[model samples]
Target: MGFLGFLRRSRHERTGYELYGAAVAAARDPYFYTGLGVPDTLDGRFDLVGLHAFLVIRRLQGLPEPGPALAQALFDAMFNDMDVNLREMGVGDLAVGKKVRAMWEAFHGRAAAYQAAMKAGDSGALAAALERNVWRGTPAGAAAAELARIALAQDTHLARQDLATLARGAVAFLPAARAVA
Candidate 1:
């Protein structure tokens, strides 16, 4: 199906298993993996998680079909890798932990809402949700929003391209942070 058509499909009407399957398939794809820069080893762990999260978001958005087992594997890998990377990045303290957790919760909550709207076949709602979750009021969010707009303008067929660009921007933030440090 086309991207808009795919987005309009309901997750509940489908099945967690089916969604999970798609995620898994997407996760295993070389193109997806390379786009996210998944390492052969567990080193640079946080980068891995960031990449996995990027991929997982795409998967949830209906980009692939690998199955639940692979999806679970990717999720576990991402969580473990992120924890290690966060500590190394100096987010080891409780305060930072709480903040990061809050950000994560907020992002995921919005993502779920976006998925629901997409499933319901509401293009307007889906676009609005993506704007709110990924764009809405922050510099980073604004950039993402602009990218999303460009992607949507192409008829939603550019999800992978848009996601790659988003991932690159996100990864770029780390280097910029390091330079400042």
Candidate 2:
């Protein structure tokens, strides 16, 4: 690759890392688990991060050039972070790879389900998906409606961004007030 190619790749990687940071930050908001009834557990947190990442990446897939590359890099970054997190949590090195691999597959499946629900263009679809995935078959209880509303709102927020801005992989999540948070 030439110098310009190198430069572009660097920029793409940076954007991906930035987008990953944004996704994780949004996922870390206490509202989802504390207020929205998402279980405050490892799987729940990973699902939330994957959800936000998918939201932005779905938008990225529509772009022409670096968008797809950046989208992929962002996905990698999420898993890379997860790998490090596992290590920090004292997961054995040999087992960490297996765990991360499982997480990647699970996240991919979740992303597909979420994208399909979002594409259905109804809050009901998203609600049902969340109720199934996040709540794990049981009803989401009082937080179901609010969580659904936020997902819909976040989707709209993503839709409103210009393709160029989105290509930069910098997504801003809309913050909603919650009774618990």
Candidate 3:
């Protein structure tokens, strides 16, 4: 790759990082924990991030050429951040890769389940998956239902957003209060 190619690639990676940051911000909204009863633990946080990231990836998949490439960049950005986070948390160097790999598999599993449920327009299925993963099968159906609703709303909102703006790494998620309401 030439200088321009390198610059172009870096630009996409930066955009991906920006987009991932936005997803993390959305996931950190207090409404999820206080209002919806999602646990305020590391696994819960990871689940929220994975959920939001999956939503963005799903939207990106529906776009054209650059869409797929951007989606790959986004995925790469997410895992890279996870790796950094593990190291920062004092996970040993040798264990970090294994931990990250487990997280990667977990993310893919949850994403697939969510995608299938959403594609079928089955809120119950979505809630079931959320309850299982986010609540660890502790029977949080009502809370999971609320989360499922928010996820559906987010998906609809993202679908209508201008693709060009999203491609530039600017995403606006629905307001937490409004979404939870």
> What CA root-mean-square deviation does each model show from the true structure?
14.4, 4.0, 2.6
TM for every model, in the order presented, reads 0.41, 0.84, 0.93
Each model's lDDT comes to 0.40, 0.79, 0.91
Task: Identify the candidate with maximal TM-score.
Answer: 3
After superposition, the stretches of candidate 1 with alpha carbons farther than 4 Å from their true spots are 1-66, 93-100, 138-181
Q: Please give, for residues 25-133, the per-residue lDDT of candidate 3 as tens digits.
A: 9999999999888999999999999999999999998999677777778899999999999999999999999999999999999999999999999999999999999
Best by lDDT: 3
Report clash pairs, candidate 1. 21-65, 21-66, 21-67, 22-64, 22-65, 24-66, 25-66
lDDT of 1 at 72: 46
TM-score computed on alpha carbons, candidate 2: 0.84
What would the TM-score be for candidate 1 when compared with the true structure?
A: 0.41
Q: What's the lDDT for residue 38 in model 2? A: 86
Candidate 2, pairs of clashing residues: none
Superposed by TM-score, candidate 3 places the C-alpha of residue 103 at a distance from the truth, in angstroms, of 0.4
- Who is ahead in TM-score, 2 or 3? 3
